[model samples]
Target: MSASISVIIPIYNGEQDLPGLIETLRSQTYPASCVEYLLVDNNSRDRTAEMLIAASEEMATQGITLRPLTEANIQSSYAARNTGIRAANSEILVFTDADCRPQPDWLTLLIEPFAKENIGLVAGEVVALPSQNLLEKYADCKDVLSQKHTINHPFCAYGQTANLAVRRQAFEQVGLFRPYLTTGGDADMCWRILQGTDWEIEFVPRAIVRHRHRATLEELRSQWKRYGCSNRYLHELHGVDLQRELKGKESLRRLARWVLKELPINTLKVATGKGSAVELLQTPLDLFSFNARTIGQREAKLPEKAKEIDRL
Candidate 1:
């Protein structure tokens, strides 16, 4: 039977997670036959591709299609994912990162919302995978507690990409995610869909996955920097007021709150060179300056393009 839905796993050196991920999907309540599990490997250096091949062979015995696609330097997961969608032979497209392992009911829970013809996409819950790592704890707290729900409206007032699934039809309408988006591709894609058309994104809490944030302090800081950089690009492309995403007054308030609640954490992070505790003081000043500069860049970009058009 042809696939009704395809699950796209965009991988990058994610060999570590393959065994658990493949096993979890196999364990899903959804028939292994109904969903084509597309393991799109973006040039993994480790055993990811090989592992997928082995898993495919094993799954083939059970009549499951564990399809694998290979490509290089699709440096962005956003690009890898769109490639997988194009390669998918299904009406619906579901996405989860290589690092997240879903519960057995994940696919069934996420796809059930599609019964409403009006629903464009569905987002599942991302729980924190049980880990001894502090980063995992932090990720779990932020992702699970801070999550929001949207049934048929803009869903990403607070967004993280670890647990998002979208319709293939929505891709044709909204266009694929930004290729240059390094980290906030999930937010960029959601915002793009919202800007172009009205599509309902159902947030199902029961359809959950565990996010495995296997990062040290250094990794966490690097990831945050990448996020900030990507946010700037996403907001610029979509013409969202950067000041709002940054939330100038709110950021200051948050900084104050952070100073109170996170000073000790900052001390550890700063001592380890993970972040700048001193820079934390400059946050309010930095927020204003950063907003000013981003606006300047936005304004400057317009004239440069206008000049090109004038010469043409």
Candidate 2:
């Protein structure tokens, strides 16, 4: 099989995660000769560039083309991904994050749907990596990074770029990701493809990427804040009205219920050793997520017309 697929991963200060990511790529069941790995460095300040160079040299003899590209002018991951998209030499492009570890068959299954010409996008499952940390456990319990929620979204089904694949032809037709978009670019891309062409999206649960959950409260807050920013972008760019957001008194009441009711019950359960720490942490995590997202949404501001569309 001629190089039919290119895996694009954007990294910034990813030295700690790159080795494991490279190992997982090396272990991919997909034939190395038929795929290229485009690792785009989004202006990392650490040893990420040197590490990528070392990885490229080491993996070269393995028939794996590990190409390292730099997106210095643009600091966004989306910008880095756009760079990879332009440099890719394949008809199909697969995307994942540096912090994720794909199962051995992840690549094989991820690109399998592209056999059908009409399949424009494929999203695999994202499962949290096992961790003893409280926040990580809470995230795992809540399925925070799972693609199921996005794939089943009411407004529009989409995929997270953490484990998504797209047909190059369809991708080009829809145009590249908003180069400067810091969040929600994946959803925007998928929506564009769906609206612009006759292409379809697929969800393959077997093609799993193990994502590291945020181990700290600060990390969790940051993640949700980005998600909130994404919500705003989607609304401004695509007119996706997120009705799920509770506002004003409703939001306060929801938080109060968690604190006044569920917290005590879960605390007692934990005290009795009948409930997992995961359950106890859920309430606080929810509160943190809500506040962070609210802040992000309030902070996110976009141009009046971020993307062009005819309202016909």
Candidate 3:
């Protein structure tokens, strides 16, 4: 028999994005009778709650169970996910963000690896949605949200929750995501599962989710800053070594080189219309991301207590 699945999404003021996700879910090729949608509202001040209620009513008749859950007290997406995880009624718990649109076969292919008893988690691919905006295009050029990036992490292979699926048993063994963690919970959970159990992580590239990239420069900076914060938390909890950005002299030398050489070359390329300006934007955008993360690491508050995995 096919495993039952629960799609858990964390929504925070997602009034604009939820409807599109609902349509995608409605069109899923997976058997609707075997799947449920748990849309967790993270105490949104917007119309997220109202939208979810309406979605629930709309999806009910289509044989897909849509539930509106609230994680009102905790202001973390991980916490909201935990609420959905606990409330989920299936053997497989699939996670995605509100700003993603899963392709029709996403759920089907994502859980396909579960047929292997040793597979603990399935990480689907995340591609930026089609965009004409320069910043969003830059994210696409870098494949910023690709599962391959995290799946090949130096410390350990993990998957972003943007397109991850975990078996209930594996989750049970490793416990739930750290409710207090605003970031890095996904990586932490994967590491714990790999170290604590015999199960393995699998990548499903065909299971794709079209994600909305950060549209503005500020949003882009904030994204990388949060990532830097995650890096710090992971280092504190698991002792993952800091990357080269913290090696003061090496970092300074690299910055000096960029300022002296690459910057002017790229600027000239854009000015002369030599090549794709979007391609040239990669280096500077990367630098911008790097600095944002570095600042985030420095500004991050270390957890006062040792990392403890939260469980039901």
Per-candidate TM-score against the hidden true structure:
0.73, 0.93, 0.93
Candidate 3 C-alpha lDDT tens digits along 1-312 = 677999999999999998798999999999988999999999999999999998899789777899999999888898899999999999899999998999999999999999999998999999888989999988888888899999899888999999999999998888999888878999999999998899899999999999989999999999988988888899988999865564557567767777888778877888888856675666667778888889888888866632656696
In candidate 2, position 55 carries an lDDT of 97
Worst 10 residues of 1 by lDDT: 303-312
Give lDDT tens digits, candidate 2, residues 83-194: 8999999988999999999999998888888777778899999998888988888888888889999999888889999999988888667688888777888899899898
Q: Per-residue CA lDDT of candidate 1, range 166-229, in tens?
A: 7777788867765545555677677667556787666788888887563565555445545455
Positional deviation of 151 in candidate 1, in angstroms?
8.9
Candidate 3 RMSD to the real structure: 2.1
Question: Which portions of model 3 show Cα errors greater than 4 Å?
Answer: 246-274, 305-308
Give the Cα RMSD of candidate 2: 3.0
The TM-score between candidate 3 and the true structure equals 0.93
